[model samples]
Target: MLFGASDSYSADEKMQITVAFTRFGKNLVQRMPRVRFGFVHVVNNDYRHWIMSAIGGSSHPTIISHGNRFRAPRNIAAKEVCKREYATEQEWKNWDWRSEGDLMLNGAIFTQSGDPKAAKKFGGYRMIAYKPAHMVPLLVRWSGTLECRPNKPC
Candidate 1:
C-alpha cells in the first residue's frame, strides 16, 4: 500500500485488480493446481510474474506483474502455479490477464513484503538480497520477449 511514485498505482487500486485477477487465477488453479514453481530476477525485458500463493491451505493465485523474470531450479515443473489473462481494463476496477504457463515456484526463497521495518516492497515481496529466489522489477521495458511471461514452452 506504500507508493513511491505520484502517478504510481495505489494499494486499493492494485487490490481491486487483484480481486478480479484472482478469479482467473483461481480458475487456473482449479483447472490445474498445485505445482512447484521456480523463481527469477527482474530485468527490463521480462514480462509477467505469478505467485503460488499459500492461501486457504492450498496454492491460490496472485498476480505479480509483467516484465519480470524468475530463476528456475533445474528440476522444476512448468504446468503448475501459473495464471490466465482475463480482459484488459482501462478503469480502476477492471483486471485482465491470461495464462503464461505453470510457474516452477519456490516460495520459501522470497520474503513477504509486510515484514516490519523493511524500507521497500516490490510485488508483494521484499528485497533482502542481490540474488533473490524471485525478482520483481518496477516496470516493463521490452516487448515480444517472453523471458518471464509466466509460462515457457518446453
Candidate 2:
C-alpha cells in the first residue's frame, strides 16, 4: 500500500515504485493464495532493503499463500544512494548503515539463477515506508529480527 503524491517524487522515481508494487502483487496472487487482504503506507522517499528481503524470502506458508499482505519492495535495484568515504590512511572500513540509503524495489519474481522463464508476474507491488526519521531506528530493529531468522544450516 505504497503512499505518496506524484509531486513528491520525480517521474523517474515513479517507475521504480511501479515496478516494485507490480512484482509483489503478481507474486502474492500467483504464489501465495492465502492472503485475504493487505495494506501499505508510503511515508516518504526512504527505502528499506533488509525488510524487503525478509518479506521476499519468508518461508511461512501464510506469507507465501496469503493473497494480500504488504511486504517489502520486490524488484529494487540497489544503488549507492548514500555513501561515506574514509580519508587519509588505509581506511579500515568506513561504512555507515544509518547513512547508507538504498531502494529495494519489488522486482520481477524469479527462481534463483536469473532465469526469465522463472519470472513470475505478480503485478505492480506497493510500499508503505517511514520517513528517513522513522527508518533510521527501524532498521536497527529489523536487523535484530533478521539475525534470529537463521540463514545458515542449523
C-alpha local distance difference test of each model: 0.25, 0.24
Clashes of each: 23, 29
Q: Estimate each model's TM-score.
A: 0.20, 0.17
lDDT for position 103 in model 1: 29
lDDT, candidate 1, 42-152, per-residue tens: 222221223342211111123232322333222233322332223122321121212222223333122222123222234344321222213323222222234554566
Q: Choose the strongest candidate by TM-score.
A: 1
Give the range where candidate 2 is weakest over 10 consecutive residues by summed lDDT. Answer: 57-66
lDDT (10s digit) by residue, model 2, range 53-127? 222211111111112123344445422222112222232122111111223334422112112221122223533
